[model samples]
Target: MTVTLSDEARQYIGAFEEETEATAVDCLVDDEFDRLVFVVKAGEMPKAIGEGGETVQHLEEEFGRDVELVEDAPTAEGFVANALSPAAVYNVTISEMGEEDETVAYAEVAHEDRGVAIGKEGRNIKAAKELAKRHFDIDDIQLT
Candidate 1:
């Protein structure tokens, strides 16, 4: 999908790429969460994060807001899993439902990590849904 980005988001991506030397494919300026969420190239997560997370920390400080990263995946299942990081996702099943054919992702998350997957105020899942819809045309995500 060709994701449209705002100028602000574009600027953020440029800065992030310059600082980390990693490729960023998309960026979401999530004002509701008071943070910037970046989707970087699949294999560049470690570089974006830097050693001991110092790179991300510096970005957060420079942006004056929390920064979150989601590694882009070729498949919807893998993308969903990456979006809900810090949570152990065992599997993801994508299915089309109802007459409208709304696409949904059913994620099997570790019971112990459910809270983390959901995040405070459902922020994690919300981000996952937004990114999924943007990249994979997924309409919803349900934890199973």
Candidate 2:
């Protein structure tokens, strides 16, 4: 289905276009959750990121909304990750189930790569927990 944009989102898109000189075609708003999602016709994700994701960061600051830009193309890794969150995980090992019932998982990558697996300030792991709760009814998911 064609995505729709709110008036505020339209304004954000306009501002982004003006500032970054990038064309944005469609946007969607999750009104209940107050999230803004954007779709770009341009095929390249790096171009969308635009010099350290600066364009998106600026737009997000201006809009004061959670903005997500998704490309139309289907990617294999993304497809697998999206399809298997909560159930199937990558580069993580279940290390311990504690007496308190909290579980710990360690990333199987190098120490430097831990941040990539766990994400910034553990947000990625938190998101993984939410997905796990939804799909598997788990209460806790931990990442090292």
Candidate 3:
């Protein structure tokens, strides 16, 4: 699916690419969370983040909001796993269920890292769901 970007998001991507010298596939402007989430091309995360996270820190300071980076994946399962980072994801299964055949990603996360997967106030899961829908047309993400 083609992901559409708002003007503001485009501008953010431009700045991020320029500063980090990395390619960004998508940017999510989450005003509710007061942060910008950038999905960079696979294997470009280190370059995007820079040494000691200085690049990300600089971008956050320049934009005046928290910055997050999620590595893009070629498959929905990998993408879902990347979206729920900092948590050990054992597996990801994408399935279509129900009468309408809604697509869902069931992530098998480490039992001990459930809180991190969910994030504080559910922000992590929210972002994961939004990204999944935007990129893969998935209806929802459920952590198991």
Strongest candidate by TM-score:
3
TM-score of each: 0.98, 0.44, 0.99
lDDT of 3 by residue, 36-141 (tens): 9999999999999999999999999999999999999999999999999989999999999999999999999999999999999999999999999999999999
Sort all candidates by TM-score, best to worst: 3, 1, 2
Clashes of each: 0, 0, 0
> Cα RMSD (Å) per model?
0.6, 8.9, 0.5
1 versus 2: better lDDT goes to: 1
**Cα error, candidate 2, residue 42 (Å):** 2.8
What residue runs in model 1 are displaced by over 4 Å at the alpha carbon?
none
- lDDT of each residue in 25-131, candidate 1, tens digit only: 99989999899999999999999999999999999999999999999999999999999988999999999999999999999999999999999999999999999
Better of 1 and 3 by TM-score: 3
lDDT of 2 by residue, 6-61 (tens): 68769867776676665666555545445555545455446655798887787778
Off by over 4 Å in 2: 1-6, 74-144
RMSD of 2: 8.9
Itemize residue pairs with steric clashes in candidate 1.
none
lDDT of each: 0.96, 0.51, 0.97
Report the Cα lDDT for residue 67, model 2. Answer: 62
